[model samples]
Target: MKVIIAVLSAVLLHCTQAMAAAQTGFFIDAPITGIQYVTSSGIEGQTDQGAYQFSDGDVVDFYLGEGPSAFHLASVSAEKWVSPNSMTVTHTRTINMTRLLLAMSDFNKSDNILTVNQAKISQPAVQDFLGELNLIELDTLAQRYDIEIPSVGEAAAHLQSSYQYIKQSLSSDEIVYAPRDTELRDILIKTRNYQGHLCFYNVDEIDNPSYVGPVGSTTYKITNKGIFEYPDNGDRYGSNDGVIASCDVDLRAKRTEEEFHEVSSFEGWSGLFACALKGCTRTNLSGYVVEEYDSGNSYKYRANAMTFNPSTQIVLNKKQGLGQHEKVDGPNNAEFIWFTFASRDVTPLSFEGQWQEKQINKEGVSYRCLDIKQGQVWATPFSDSHCRARNSAGFKNASVEFGDMWWLQSSAKDLYFYHLNIPVAWKDSNQTQHYTTWEYLPVSDSLNNGILYRYQQILDEKDQSLRTSQVSELTKL
Candidate 1:
């Protein structure tokens, strides 16, 4: 029994040692090659195709050239994919290292890999030139290469531009940079080939019969560049649909927390009574929000509530030639708007042909409609003349101008008529004029043989009021 136990202990020790052995990784920001890397674990070599091998907990320092003349560029913990930005601790240092890397790289190569020009970078003259450059000089160099580095408080914008520049320069569809010990790196390694259809549902509509809401379906694809949604048309108001950012994976919850920005406009009026009202207020609002989503299960994502100040202009009496206006600042105000989405495997369905309004609320309805070949909806049923005639009793000469219609397919294989900033004006019976815009997403229902239109919420221009629900249906005509 002692002999057997000794043999088993030996085997276990061997296995543990093997697990601690060096693992392969890459240096990117275009897969830089021919750079020497030395790890604290004693592993040292010039990167081949940007590849290196190091064990966990190892700190790596990168250099150029050889012998006493070799120049140290940056030092970072061993990672699967290391870039200049990841190696540096401060933004200024990151920019400096990035500029040096760009200056030393051979961009004319056809393979899209950045091969460090050893001959040029090793020269004392070239080193001096790069070392003497200050922030303004670096900015000039970046501009010459058409690369944009955003100002302070614009990290998101800078990252976006970096991603775009890398994508364009490489002409490659997949581009990713994973720093050490990051969830993004783990996610990329685990789901490198993941691609499918994702259906989005509003958080409040998950318990509803059809999971219907403002959000719809989109194709989610994973590339080295991170997850992107195909045909991402910014479905939700003031929110972008493509290229989710700052994603942190939660394996236990099977979801990822992502950051996004929501932009909107604020408007207000100041007056005690109708006779005293003669002022206008408008302000633009933008802020970041974080939301969570599970790739394989139903999850909810919400935009953070935000606050903003409104700019106001007042005119006391227009008829008295008191057209003089004074600008005033209003107190800070806040707003919160959020929705959730559910996803499923994409089922193929073509929405290329024409679909006509068939029924609304179980009542037969007909409308002349044509789906333009260029993916536009041209329907004449809701013209200005029709609107004026229908609401003539309450609003005289009322006009409704329909905005461009963009068709969006949902995960349920139905369609949503997405419209934006549709201007509407009407004069009430008392001749008081009103003007505003409307944004709405009206969804469709699938019958055994026909499509049915259901009730949809319409948001007014200010996003403060709800317009009356408009129900309509359409079928292939």
Candidate 2:
């Protein structure tokens, strides 16, 4: 939740003054009416991590979204804090929609509540607590007893809202950071409303509003369907042009964990990295280091997966050392923990868990599955319903969510270059693990692969500009 707080610092401000004008029809500080959920958890204890406990079928209404961006917690005592004494304190947090979706995802076990732009947010403790506040004990509760309940999906969303109450409250010294997205797999990040530069829209445009919207700006152009159009320096192309800019996507309602189709195609590591020297900075990665290979063997960069390489894959002896994270959406010092209030995690989502829950879907897949014999079959490593690799090449309406954390979409499809969040991981020669929140733009046409180009770019952070050092790539297991 530390990284989430930092992202929210900008997201809260951005959404407040987002493109929504007074005349535009959008909810502003609107209250979520009819807010109520199961009240108490009859079972009480702590998880292995020492978090508060709840019955498997507990009912709770942690808080309600007072508006599109504001939230209120009914009770703080039920939350997970390092200290149980901290629960007595009640507070409201200025969480942005991005982080809110993440919290809701873990709490509700659904990652598609809202669209994540560049990073993934996870608070396992939040999910654990909220998951308990469900209508599980409907027969026990008088309000729900003998009453027809909503379908699992509908109930899932409503029940997930219970996280508001149990969501952790950041202390005075607590700082928030974004959870890492990981490497080699295709990931997506949104450019709209973000301070980052895009193939068509650069930060200079915001600094100097010389031209309005996409057409007036000479820097880049947009298509009828919100796609960007541009001349390529090479043969690469999208939208029948050199490249295409797309939007961030939401996987909120696509599939369920009931052995459905696999949502993500690439099983390899997917993450972001920063290669710039001077003005560049990096910070705040979450979770533990996943020992992909046996600890004694360490890790290796293979032929198929490359985190920093644009085309030619390089081999790394151990994990390369990472510097500070370069600011992605906000200021260069994007990680300043000004917001004292930190959100507690309820329940964190696990990759293996998501994959296990994932069922197969064939609508947008690129590869034909030989695994499917007659009826829908559960996805296995061999028969996985992953998205086609080439289809990721220059996609038209593509979006991605890796490890259920980060989300990205193209700015426009026509542009030749892109600045994106690529996931990277490695162990230092010292045997220390390192995670990179890569936010580099590959040179023109280098990012044309529709399968998983993170996002479009501007002239300043172009692909041909920088040379990324070798780190590690996720090989196909």
Query: How does each model score on lDDT?
Result: 0.37, 0.22
Task: Give the per-residue lDDT digits (tens) of candidate 2, residues 1-477.
Answer: 999998999898776653231110101111121222222433322122122333222222233222222122222212212111111110001112212323332321342222221111123333222222211122222132232223322322332232222232222223222222211211122222122222122222222322111211111121122222222121111233313422212222122222212223222323222221111111111111111232343332111111112121111111111112332223211011000100121112111111111121112112221121112122223233443322122322111112111211122222211222322222333544333333222211222221111211112254212122221111111
What local lDDT score does residue 208 receive in model 2, on the 0 to 100 scale?
Answer: 32
TM-scores of the candidates are: 0.29, 0.17
Which candidate ranks first by TM-score, i.e. highest? 1
Best by lDDT: 1
Question: How far out, in Å, is residue 424 in model 1?
Answer: 56
TM-score of 1: 0.29
TM-score: model 2 vs. ground truth = 0.17
Model 2: residue 41 alpha-carbon error in angstroms: 4.2
Model 1 scores worst on lDDT over the 10 consecutive residues at 312-321
lDDT of 1 at 449: 21
